[model samples]
Target: MNKTDLLKSIIERLEIDLDMIQRAAQTAYETATAEENIAENKYDTLSLEASYLATGQARRMEEIRQACKAYQQLTMRDYDPERGIQISNLVQLEDAQGNQQLLFLGPEAAGLQIGTGPSKVTVITPRSPLGQQLLGKFEGDEITLVLGNGRQVQEVVSAW
Candidate 1:
């Protein structure tokens, strides 16, 4: 898969999310400031709750904005096998059962899956457990990944 195309796809997904969050924030703000939502007594908290939701939505919007900026400013480069895997590297891993998984190491937006079926690629951040294990690993290297209560070993089939 082309890294440039993947980056563009990620940015497009983020932009959609940002738009949704913006709309939700606007609705929450309106609800919070509406006259009908005004608290009439100590027991009334609808306005307060709406205000809190609006604040949370706003914070999420800012986070997505920052993530978009980070991804936009990210420099895409080919991974040097001698130096091991690093961010922006597209890695393919295979399990003992012959199951294959494609992962794109990104600066942010972990858990975002692009595409479908066998072509699907999941984005993982350096801070993620699997991402941490994948770093500094070379092709054909066995990596032990911790999954919930179990551990699975997979080999790095390729990186580029």
Candidate 2:
């Protein structure tokens, strides 16, 4: 398939995850608020107090809102090699060392890399080590990573 077809397929598949994330976020917000209001349920205090644990409950809501926004941004995206390297971006990079990978970032750890059949691409998330390496890079610029074998690999290859 062409780039347009590939991108369209990605966008279509991403909607399923985006919808689930949005629902989960919305549920968390409502549950938090409702538990805060439930004066009769003493055990429900945990939910009411969860925000204190994760920092600000209000901030959590804001974060979920932002996540939904990011999902929306991703769902509408067409493959653009010029978007620059960063989180939530599907980037391709090549370092002086020579490791290559394709990225498809979601709100969390979720995805698969299908080779051959239809979409022959290496799937990875922004949370992975490789993802972290390619998080902020430009074409031709080098990115290197150390291995458990005491060897450093500086290989990174990117496609749009």
Candidate 1's TM-score reads 0.96
- Candidate 2 lDDT over residue span 1-160, tens digit each: 2444544555555555556655665666566566445656666575655435434544544554564455556542433456546544555544444544555544443454434642365456677776776665665556556677664555334544
Question: Model 1 over residues 1-160: C-alpha lDDT tens digits?
Answer: 9899999999999999999999999999999999998999999999999999999999999999998988999999898978899999999999999999999999998998999999899999999989999999999999997778999999999999
Q: Which candidate's lDDT is highest?
A: 1
TM-scores for every predicted model: 0.96, 0.42
Tell me, by TM-score, which candidate is best: 1
After TM-score superposition, what is the CA distance of residue 58 in candidate 1 from its true location, in Å? 1.2
- After superposition, candidate 1 runs with Cα above 4 Å error: none
Against the unseen true structure, what C-alpha lDDT does each candidate score?
Answer: 0.94, 0.52
Which RMSD does model 1 reach against the true structure? 1.0
